[model samples]
Target chain A: MSVLRKSTVALVAQRAGVSVASVSRVLNNLPASESIAAKVRKAAEELGYVPDAMARSLKVGRTEQIALAVADVGNPVYVTMMHAVSEVVREAGFRLVLSSTGNDPNDVVELLDNLERGYADGVILSPLRITDEIIARLTSTRLPVVVIGSLPQGVLLDNVRADSRTGVDIAVARLKATGRKHIAFVNGPVDTVPGSARLTGYLAAMESRGLPTTADMQVEASDFTYAAGLEAAQVLTAQATPDAILCANDLLAVAVMKVITSKGLRVPEDVAIVGMDNTDLADHANPSITSVDLGSAERAREAARLLLARIEDPSRPSETTVVSPWLAERESTAEGASRGKNVKARKPELEEGVS
Target chain B: MSVLRKSTVALVAQRAGVSVASVSRVLNNLPASESIAAKVRKAAEELGYVPDAMARSLKVGRTEQIALAVADVGNPVYVTMMHAVSEVVREAGFRLVLSSTGNDPNDVVELLDNLERGYADGVILSPLRITDEIIARLTSTRLPVVVIGSLPQGVLLDNVRADSRTGVDIAVARLKATGRKHIAFVNGPVDTVPGSARLTGYLAAMESRGLPTTADMQVEASDFTYAAGLEAAQVLTAQATPDAILCANDLLAVAVMKVITSKGLRVPEDVAIVGMDNTDLADHANPSITSVDLGSAERAREAARLLLARIEDPSRPSETTVVSPWLAERESTAEGASRGKNVKARKPELEEGVS
Candidate 1:
C-alpha cells in the first residue's frame, strides 16, 4: 500500500464499462453474470489487476504473493538474497513468501509443479542441484520463474549468475596484496555448476599470478556447506598450513577458520583466508572475514526484477545476466578497525552463454 | 552435571583457557577453531583426560506425534519455540511435526483444516495474525490445538501466553537499574492481541515507575516484522533520541539499534535498547541486544504439554498458562566485561490468568 502502486477495482470497472460492485463480484467470484464476468476479466487482464488483493494488501500483495524457493535457510547467503528479493518484489506490488526447498532435484520439480496450482504468481528459485527433470519442468511450467543460479545448455529461462572469475580474481588480488604467497584453494565437487566455474577460475587466476598450484594445493569439499568445509579443511590442514587459503564460499571459509583456530593458530596472523560470496556469515564471524563478493544479493534482486518483467509480459527473451564481483576486505585477511561498513555487492551485466 | 564427568573436560578447559563446550566440541570432532582444538588437545594430552563414559541413554516408544505450525521460519523465535516444543513432545512419547503456516489467515485456516485429514494427534499453533475466522476454526476444529499466543476472551483452547507484566518489568527494571529514564516504546499494531497487551503493559509499567509518558514516546509498527520496525524506528529516531528504547520484539530492537548506530549514536553508550523475545537474532546482532526474555521456549514447552494432555484426555478442562519472563542482559544494556558465554534462557513457571 505504501510502496507499491496497485491496479484498483475502480480502474478495472472504468475499463470494463461496469460498476465497481460488478468488478468486485466478478473478481471475488460471487455469482456475477457471465457477460459481466467476461468484461471484468478482460479489463483486469489488460490492467494486470492482481486477483483478490485482499487478505495480504490486506501487506505486500496477498492474492498474488511471489514465492522465493531457496536451497537452505541456514545459510546467510540466502538470508541476504531473500532480503534483496523481498524488497524488489514488494516494490512492484508483490509480497515475497519463502520456502526452503530441499536439496533433492525431484524436490525442485515438485515445487515447480506445485506452481501449476497457482499458489504463487511466479517464483525465483535457487536450487543447489540441477537435474534434467527440473529443466523439463521449467520448459513446461507456465509460471514465470527467474533462476538465480546456473541452468544447463540450451535451457531458456531468465537467469542471473555470479561471475566466478571476478570472485577468484578478487580473492587472489587481496591475498597477494596482503603478502601471502602460499595460498591454497578449497572448492566443491568439480562436476557441479559453481564448482566447475570456480575451480577453473582459480586455476586461471593463479596462472596470472605466476603461482605454482600443484594438485596437492587444491582441496575439494563434498559440497559448499560448512559441514563439507570442516571435513575438507581437516584434510587440507593435515597436509600443511598455507600462508593463505581461498575458500569456495563464506561457509567454507568459516569452517576453515574454525579448523585453523582449533589447531592453535590465529586467523590472518598465521593463515590469511579469503572466502567467496561475501555473505553475512563473513561479516559476523569472529575476527570477521575478507570475502570475494559474488553479489548474490544483486543477483537475487535482478532475478526478482526479471521475474516481474516476465510476469508483466511473458514473451520477453530469456537473457542471462552476470553480476560482477568485488572484494569485501576484513579482519580474516588482516585484523583491522574498519568493520561492518565495507561489505559490498556489485551490479549485473547481461552476459552471453552462461560464461 | 548428573551423567557427564566434567573433571576431565574442565581440567582441559582450564589448562587451555577455553570453554568446556569448546573442549568438548574439539574432542568430540565437532566444529571448533583449530587453534582452540589444538590447545584443548594439548591440554587433554598433558592431563591425560580420557572421557569417562561411553554408553548413551536413548528414549523410545512413541505411538503418535503433535504438529507445531509456526508463523514464520525467518524469525529465529520460531526456531527456539520449535526446539523447546520438540523436546517436550518427544519426552512425552510423541514426536513433534512442524508446519510453517504463512502470515495469511487463510493459511492458518487451511493448516488447521488439513489437520482433519489425520495428520497428527494434536497441534501447537503460533499464528501471527489472528482473525475471527481463525477463532471459529479453532473452536470448531476436531483436532486438539494448543496456541502459544493470546486467544480472544472466552474462546478457551489451551492457550499459553507470555506474561507481559514480567517482560515489561524485566525490560524496565534493567533499563532503570542502568539509570535510563527517558525510555521510548515501539509497539506493533494495537489491534493485535500481543500488541495490545505489550503496549498496555509498557504504558502501565512506565506509570508505575513515576515516569511521564507522551503520545510522541510511543510508536506503532504496522506489523511485528523487521521491515515494519525499520519504518517505525525511522519515525521514532526522527522525533528525538531517547535515553533508552524498548521494542515489542527482538526484530524491532535490532531495527532500532541499526537506526541508532547509523545516526552515529552508539548503543548503551549513547542509548540503551531492550527488546522482548530473546531469540538468536538478538544474540547475533552487533553489540548483542539485551532483551526481556518472554520465555517463548517455556511457552512452547507448555503448549506441547497442553496439546499432549488434551490429546490423552479430551474431558480435561481447557486451561490458560502464563510463562515467566526475565532479562537477558547483553551489550545493548551495558558494555560489560563478560561477553558471549553468558547467554541465558530461563525455564517456564506457568502462572494463571495471563498476568
Candidate 2:
C-alpha cells in the first residue's frame, strides 16, 4: 500500500503558504524572488514533494527520453543493436528506454498508442512485421520516430536499414568463388522483411553468376532459430547434398554447420557454409563461419542519429540511410586442408571429455 | 513544416461546448452523462487530442512502466538476464525501460535521481559495483525497487542473487575430482562485486579441497572482456602451466581455451578449463567449455517477481531470494584419445574436395 498520497503542486503551495502559480514558477525555475524560491523549496523538501517528471513533461513538451523498440532482445543481433543505440542516445544526453515487442501484434498496437500518449520525446522502432494499420498509425503520429527496418513504398519516415540484398549477394559470391557450383539457399520465413529480401537476393545473385537455380536446392526454415535451421537443413541434405549452403542469419548458419558436421561432413571441404549478420556467434563457431557483415552497430547508431535529428527539426525532409554489406571470410570457406586439419585435430579432445 | 499545436483539455472542452470538468470526466471515464461523453469523445477525435500519459500518470500515481538498469547489455550474460526480465515485466502488463549505466558512477547517481523524479512505477537493477552510498539511497527510495545482486550486511531491500560461492565451489570441486591438482583461478577485476565474490569462492574452494593456493595460480584480468581474459591467460601461462584453470565467466574461459590450445597444450589432457555463467557461448565453444550455471534467468525472474510483490504491497517486509548454482560439464574436461581418432578421419575428405 502507498504510505502517503503523492505530493502535488497544490500541496506544496499550501505548505509554503503561497499561490499555486508562485509554487509552479519557483519549482520550474521561472522568474521568482529568492525568498519565495527558498520558501517553496523548503516546503517541497519538508513534504518530500517531487515535481513529477510526467507533469513537468506536459508543460515542457519534451520528456528528454527516447524509446528504442525492437522485436526481441534475446537475439544476439538485436542485442548488439540495442547496445549501440543505448550508447549513442546516452551520449546525446537523452535517457534511453527500451521495449521489446516480443513479436506480438498487440504489443505493436500498444506501442503506437503509448507513443501517441507522449511517454517519450521520440522513438526508434525496428518492427518485425509491417502492416497497413501500423503504417497508418505511424504516418499520423505527432512525435518524431525513426524505423530501423525496411518500410513499404511511399510510407514516409526517417529509416535506417541494412542492405540485406547486398549481404546475401556477398555470401553467395563468396561460396561461388570457392568453386562451389551446387549451392543451396537456406532462409527464414518469407513473411519477414529480411527473410524475403535475402531469398530474392540469393536467387538474383545465383542467376547473375550464371549458376543454376533449382527449387530443390532452396530451403525455408520455420524461423530464424537454431532448431529450425537444423530441421530445415536436415530435410534439404536428405534430399540433395549441395556443395555449399548460404544461410540467412548467423544462428542458422551455425546450426546448419553443426548438423552437417555431425553427419560426418567437413566444412569448406565437404560443404562450405556462410551466414549473414556477422554476429559474435559467427566468429565463435568451430569453423568460424564466413558471414556477410550487414553493419548492425552502424545501423543502430545511424537510426539513433536520425531520430535525434528529427526530434531537433521535425520539419526536415525524411531520409533513409542504408548501411552497406561486406563478406568476412574465415575457416568455413577456406580453400586449403590446413585449417580443416587443425579443427579435426582439436575435435577429439572435446568429444572424449564431454560434449 | 509545422503542422499545429498539440490539442489541450481546454480546446476539447471548447469544441464540445461543455465544462472542462465534464470533458475530464468523460476522458478519464469517471462519472459522466452519455450525451456529454459522446460530445467530448467527438471533440477529442476531431481535434486529434491525445490525452497526455505523463499528466494522467501524475493524477493516477502510476506510470505502468518499470525500469531495469544494467551495467552493460553488450555482455551476453546481462543480455540473457535482460531478455528474461523483459518477458516477466511485459507479461505483468508493465512496460520495461532499459538503462545501461556503462560502469559510470555518475550514471548510477543519475539513475537514482531519475527514479526519484517519478520516471517509472518500479525498478529492477543489476548493479556491477554496489556501494554503501547506493545501498543508502535504495534503502529510502520512495519507489519500489529490486536489486539482482548481493546486498551488504544489515542493509534491507528486495534482492535476488545467485550463489556464486557455491557456483565456484562446484567448478573447482569438479576439476579436482577429475585428477587436476595444479588449478588456476582466472578472474576479472576484484573491485567489482562478482569479481571479488568469485575470487573469494575460488580461494575457499581450493582450501576446502586441500589444493595448494599458490600466488602463481592466481591471475586477475583487467576486465571481463575476451581480450583481457586472453592477456591474463597469456601472463599466467607464461609463468607456469596449470593443469586446470577455472574462469570467472564464459568469455574468459573461451579466450583462455584458445590461448591454451594455441600453445600446443590439449584441453583436459593438459589443461582443463571451467567457466562460470553458463551462457550460450559456453556450449558454442569449439571444445564446449565446462561452466558453472549461475542461473541468470532465474535471478531476473525472481527479481521481477519480488518487485511486483513489493509494488502490490509496499508495507510488506523486504525479502532476499538467492538462486542456487550448478555445474555444466562439457568437452574441455573430457578424457582420452578415442574421440580424437574419429575427427582426424573426417579431415581428409574435405581436403580432397575443392575446399
Candidate 3:
C-alpha cells in the first residue's frame, strides 16, 4: 500500500534543485523558463507529488464538496431528487455527501456542525419539518445553503420550492369532474410543510367546487410511509367509502393502491386515486398510478444550481425558484380525466398561480 | 454570516497564557495539571475554538466518511442495500458518500484516484463486473474496501456474496412440482455477474430436475429493467408459450407480469411467474410476485460490519461471508404451493450448503 501524505512544493523544489518559488511557478504555469519547468515537472513526477485538492481547498476556504440532506432515502421522490442533485454536483466538479434524517434524529444540528467545520462548500437540504431552529442556523452558517421546500416568508436563504397547492387543485378538479361527490384525501403528518399545504389546497379546491369535505373525507397518516398509507386507507374506507382518493405523495399512493386492489377493488372503476411526485414507482405500478409531477428532478437541479451560484458569489440576492407541478395522467385516474377537455395541467398556469 | 476559519493551537495558548504544547496536551486529554487544563478549556470556549474535525482528521489521516458505489439506484434491491449500509454507517458515527456507476462510468477509476487522495476512510463497492484491473487496484489501495459480490478464487480481500444457485433450484423445483411441462427463463444480460450466475443456476437446476432444456425456452433481456422485461416476455411468448417463467430480477418479473395480464393471460392459471431480489416491487405488484430473497439487507449489514472490523484492525485475516438465498412464495406462484406442505424453505440447510 502506498503511504499517501500531503505533497509540498518544498519537496518538489529540493528534487529539482530549485527554490520553492520556482517550483510554484512551474506548477501554476507562470513565467518559468522551459528548462527549469521541465526539470521541476520531471522531479514532481518522479516524487508523485501533485497539489492535493484538500490542501488547495483548505487554502482557498473551499472544500469542493456539496452535501445533500434529505428526510429519507427510501422515498422514491427523494431518491429521484438525489440522483439529479448528484448529477448536477458532479458536472459542476464537486463531490456530494449524503445524510438521511431517518437515521440521524439530529440532522439539522449535524448540518450546522459540518458547515462550521468546513466539511463542504455548500449544502442543499430538504427538511421534513421547517422550524425556527432551522432558519436560524441556516441564517448564521457561513457556508452556502439552498432549501428544497417551503420556508417562512422573507427568509434569506436561497430556496427551490414546489407548487403543490396547484397540484392538489388539479387533482381535486379532475376527481370532481368525474361525477364524484365524496372525495377522500390522505396526507402525512400535518406538522410537515407538505402535509399542511396539501390539506389546505384540498379544502380550498373542494370549497371552490361547492363540495363539502366532511371529517371522514380526510385522513392524516402518522407518517409518509406505505405502512401508514395502508392504515390510513383502512380508517378512511371503514368510515366512508369515497369515490376517489388523493394521496399527498406517491409512496402513500402506491401503498393505498395495493390495499385497495388486495381488497378486491378495481382502481378507476370502484375508486380513483391520485398521487403526488411522479416517480418511477408511479409508472411501474400495476394500472400505472396517476400522479402530480411535483418536479422532483427539476427542483433538485435548480437547488444545486442556486447553491452553486450562491457559493460563487455570496453577495448575490437570495432568490426563491418554484418549479410548477403538473398532473401525469395514467390509468389510475384515467376514468375521470377526459370528463373535461384540456384539464391536463400546464406549467404556465401553475407558475402564475403560485408565484 | 459569521466567518468560519480554522483556529490554531497558538490562539488557544495565547488566550490561556500558556505554551502551544500545553494547549495540545489539554486538548488530547493528556495528563496535565488540573488548573492548566481548566484554563485551556475556558480559553478555548472564549475563543470559539473547538478542535475542528477536519483539521484533526488531516493531522491523523482519518476522515469519518465511507463511500458506497452501486451500479444503479433505480433498482429497488440496490436501494435496499444502500439503506442498510447507510443505517449501519450512521450508527457507527461515520458519514456515507454515494456514487452510482450508472451516472459515473469511471466509478472504479475514480475510487482508486480518491483512495490515493484520501477521499474516504473505507469503501464498500458492488461492482457489476469484476476484472483483473479492479483486483489489482483493490490490492494496491491503502483504504479499506469490502466488495459485496463474488470475486475470483484465492484473491484475498474481504467479500460478502450471495448464493443464487440454491435460489434458482428452489424456484424450479417449486414450479415443476405443480406438473408444469414447459418452463421458461428470462435472464438479464449474461455479461453481468448476477445475470451470468442466475443463468448458470437455471440451467443446472433444470438438468437436475430431469427436464429437457430447449433453446426456445430461454430468453435473455438486454438489461434488468421493466421495459426490458416486457420486451423479453414478448419474445418468449411469441415463439413458444411456457407454462411458467422465472425472471432474473423483480423489475423484469413485474414488467412481464404486467404484459401477461394486459394481454388477457391469467397468472398462475395460464402461466406462473417468479422473480429474484424479493424487493418491495414484488409485494406491491398486482399479483404479488413470488421471488427469491437474495438477502440484500443481510449482506449489506454484514459488509458494513466487516468493513468496520477491517478498519478497526486491518491485520486480521480476511474473511469471505456468503448470504444464502430463499424463496418467498406469493400469489403469482400459488398454483402448486399447497401440493406439498413443506414448501417454506428452511435456512439451516441452505446455510450449511453454501458454507
TM-score per candidate, chains pooled = 0.54, 0.78, 0.79
Candidate 2 deviant stretches above 4 angstroms: A1-61, A338-355, B1-60, B335-355
Give one digit per residue, the lDDT tens place, for model 2 in B1-355. 0122223766787999977556654655544679988998888789876655423632344566788888876577887887787778767667787777777666776787776665687889888889877887788888898999888867789998889999999988887766667789999999888999999999999999998878988999988878898899999998865778999999899889878877877775567899999987787676778999999999999898888767655767989999999998998887442222212322343223221
| Candidate 3 lDDT tens digits, B114-210 | 5445556688989888878788888778788899999999988999999988889889998877655577999998887898899999999999999
| TM-score values for chain B across all models | 0.74, 0.77, 0.77
Query: What is the Cα-based lDDT of residue B346 in candidate 1?
Result: 10
Task: For all candidates, state DockQ relative to the true structure.
Answer: 0.04, 0.36, 0.38
Report the candidate with higher lDDT, 1 versus 3. 3
Q: Kindly give the number of clashing pairs for every candidate.
A: 17, 4, 0
Interface RMS for model 2: 2.1
lDDT of 2 by residue, A1-355 (tens): 1113323666777898876656665654545679988888898889876656423632344466788887866567887887888778777567887787766667777886765555687888887777787788788888888998899978789998899998888777777665667789899989888888998899999999988878889999998877788898898888876878899999889888978887887886677899988887787676678999899999999998888767655778999989999998888888763322323323343223221
**What overall lDDT goes with each candidate model?**
0.74, 0.78, 0.78
Docking class of 2: acceptable
Quick one: ranking by TM-score, best first? 3, 2, 1
List the pairs of residues colliding in candidate 2: A1-B314, A269-B350, A348-B340, A353-B334
The residue-level lDDT of candidate 2 at B70 comes to: 87
For residue A47, model 3's alpha carbon misses the true position, in angstroms, by: 28
Give the number of the best model, judged by TM-score.
Answer: 3
Which model, 1 or 2, shows the larger lDDT? 2
